[model samples]
Target: MSGARYWRHQDQRYNMAGNECGVCGSRFFPGKTMCPNCHRRSVGKMKKFYFNGNGKIITYTIIHEGSLQYRNQVPYLLAIIELEEGDKVLGQIVDCEASDLAMGKKVEMVFRKLGEQGKSGTIQYGYKFILK
Candidate 1:
């Protein structure tokens, strides 16, 4: 990714920063300019929200074939996590084996190196989940 683009999303990638609707009390990841539920009422009522990163795995799958950027990390576990505050997010489950995971398992966010732009490009960092 370009430096500008990567830097632009630094907050959300590094901190799980999202947005909450002041009008209807709805929260979103990657933040939103307006709340879908409250619509017009949420036009200027969206506020920044920082997730606590505590959640549970609602479902999961083991990846034996990954994309070009993540091929080296194949055989990893990915899951749909239901955050404690109620937002569901997709994240890679690290530091554990597939045999160790199951639905409804507890997890917590951990900061780690996600990937790089290329061999000589930017080293991207982001959040990944680990068993609690």
Candidate 2:
């Protein structure tokens, strides 16, 4: 994660989406290198965009056995959120109890420190789901 593609994914503000197929006017998230429907490799970067980062809880799970970085954060949530635009993504739900969460619950995105800053000592910032 030290090259062009690495830096590209590091842009957290950019909605984890932005792929376009030149062969078709289709757009995709996680930036597809090729079109899944048309099977064309003529893909290019689409305009960068951001979502409110707020969405509805569609599903979730609790992780017990995890990395040392998140082991203490146990009983943590890994949830599927459905954005306003219908795009769904998995994220960690913070600041609330699992009992307090449910399907169709509203969640707001907040920048959260993901792990021990990878030698930088500064934690990497990313999105988290909070009960709204």
Candidate 3:
């Protein structure tokens, strides 16, 4: 059986996210149904692409309150990363000291299991960032 089109479009290899526009030759991350520039819903998707997984921190915060899974991972880093592809994404940071957090700092992504999808479902694994 075929999976959801969005699931197939995301590059599991690198956690790259992009959506193409039918009205304009533009792309966006964190996939959506409509184009922001032209306000059109007829978006086009080309072949899947992998991101470089290296970005600079745009903005971030240390999370103290979160889900059960993140309870012990408090003071965790969640940041808006500006990718090399020119897309900004929100994701977690790992494998580095919290003191290293800084705007415009270089980061590299590491794929890790986010958590179980509710219960008795998929174990979602995605990319996370670490100081470079």
TM-score on alpha carbons, each prediction: 0.85, 0.70, 0.72
| Segments of candidate 3 deviating more than 4 angstroms | 1-11, 45-48, 117-122
Q: Candidate 2 lDDT, tens digit per residue, 46-96?
A: 433356566899999988877777787886889998876435778899998
lDDT (Cα, 0-100) at 121 in candidate 2: 54
Model 3's alpha-carbon lDDT is 0.72
Q: Which ten residues in a row have the lowest lDDT in candidate 1?
A: 4-13
1 against 2, candidate with superior TM-score: 1
Minimum summed lDDT over a 10-residue window in model 3 is located at 1-10
Candidate 3 lDDT over 7-113, as tens digits, reads: 54555554565655666645566555766776744545332445667889999898889778787688788999998765688989987776889999999877776
User: Pick by TM-score: which candidate is best?
Assistant: 1
- Count the clashes in each prediction: 0, 0, 0
Candidate 3: give its CA RMSD in angstroms: 4.4
Where model 1 places Cα greater than 4 Å from the true spot, the runs are 1-14
Roughly what TM-score does model 1 have, to 2 decimal places? 0.85
